[model samples]
Target: MKKIENLRTDYKRDQLNESSLASCPIEQFKLWFNEVLDVIIEPTAMVLSTYSQNKGVSSRVVLLKELQQDGFIFYTNYNSLKSEQIKLNPCVSLLFFWPDFQRQIRINGLVQKISHESSVNYFKKRPRKSQISAWASSQSSVIKDRFVLEALFHDFEKKFKNKTISKPPYWGGYKVVPNSIEFWQGRESRMHDRFLYTKHQNNKWIINRLSP
Candidate 1:
């Protein structure tokens, strides 16, 4: 096997110059996101990091369900560990990495639960099995085994049989309102391109380029 240290990739596919970047980071994100739609699988997947005094830090991959001008949205069980951490500390970080494009985007933000109506609207759109699973799973809870989960799923399945499943009272969405967002592009010889957009007090974005 080849040595891990010997493995390297020199990115030369693209470059992000100030003149070509949008004044609004969200617009820029939409541009790059649309470009990758044809080339990347699960393009909406992002790494969400949350921290609390008790837990220190935790990270997990979560699907990005919606993106608005103000924030990004994702849903989960309210009783989950991440939710508990968020309740204690609302600040969080999000990361989106697309190796195929040698690109990454990092966002730092504050999270808040989105409106119950909005959560229910999104929840109802999910596939029936997924909706049922959301009702059955007590997220982040320890169980005896896989069979226990399977049993719960089957029980919920029958309970909701021939009926419209309602969104669980404890399952909903959170919005991460970003304060800063950084876009990173890998380049040759490790001279990468990095640009950060910070929200100013006036609610305008201040952009700055940093050394790779």
Candidate 2:
């Protein structure tokens, strides 16, 4: 492997100011989300980090689809390691980085499940195969070979034929209600922009500038 002595990509495109950022985390998140939604391809890809009582810590990239006053929402099997981690320790964090935009968003919060009605609604909206997969496969469980998964998939496909698919009891969405959200924008020579919105005890969000 050859190593290059000097490699640089100058980022002088833009900066995030304290004035432009909202005092509330939700508002600031929406503002930055709107800005990056257009320029970055697959802007929703995020790294969700969670700590489990038995499993310690784990992180995997997943797509974040919904944001609400309560928290950020993403769906997965409740039995998955990540889901189990949230059950043991609700303290969760999400990271979204866009190299093209030279921007990143960090959130720290607690996790909770959404309403059953909401889960059912989201389940019904999934493609037929996904619904079957949700019912067929036991998420995070070990399987012997490809034939095992294939057999389970086809079994569920036949079972759900011409019938309404329901959300699995162990599969649904979890929300990460952020107590703090920090947005980072890379600048020239490493003098970057860092703005953080923190929610206090009384439920008011206070914006502060962090040293970059």
Most lDDT-accurate candidate: 1
Candidate 2 residue 88 C-alpha distance from true site, Å: 1.0
lDDT of candidate 1 over 1-212, digit per residue (tens): 99999998999999999999999899989989999988999999999999999988999999999999999999999999999999999999999999999999999999999999999999989999999999779999999999999999999999999999999999999999999999999999999999999999999999999999
Identify the runs in model 2 with alpha carbons over 4 angstroms from their true place.
1-7
Estimate the TM-score for candidate 2.
Answer: 0.93
Q: Pick the candidate with the highest TM-score.
A: 1
lDDT of 1: 0.95
Clashing residue pairs in candidate 1 (N, C-alpha, C atoms within 3 angstroms)? none
Worst 10 residues of 2 by lDDT: 1-10
lDDT of 1 at 43: 96
Model 2 CA RMSD to the hidden true structure, in angstroms = 1.7
lDDT of each: 0.95, 0.87
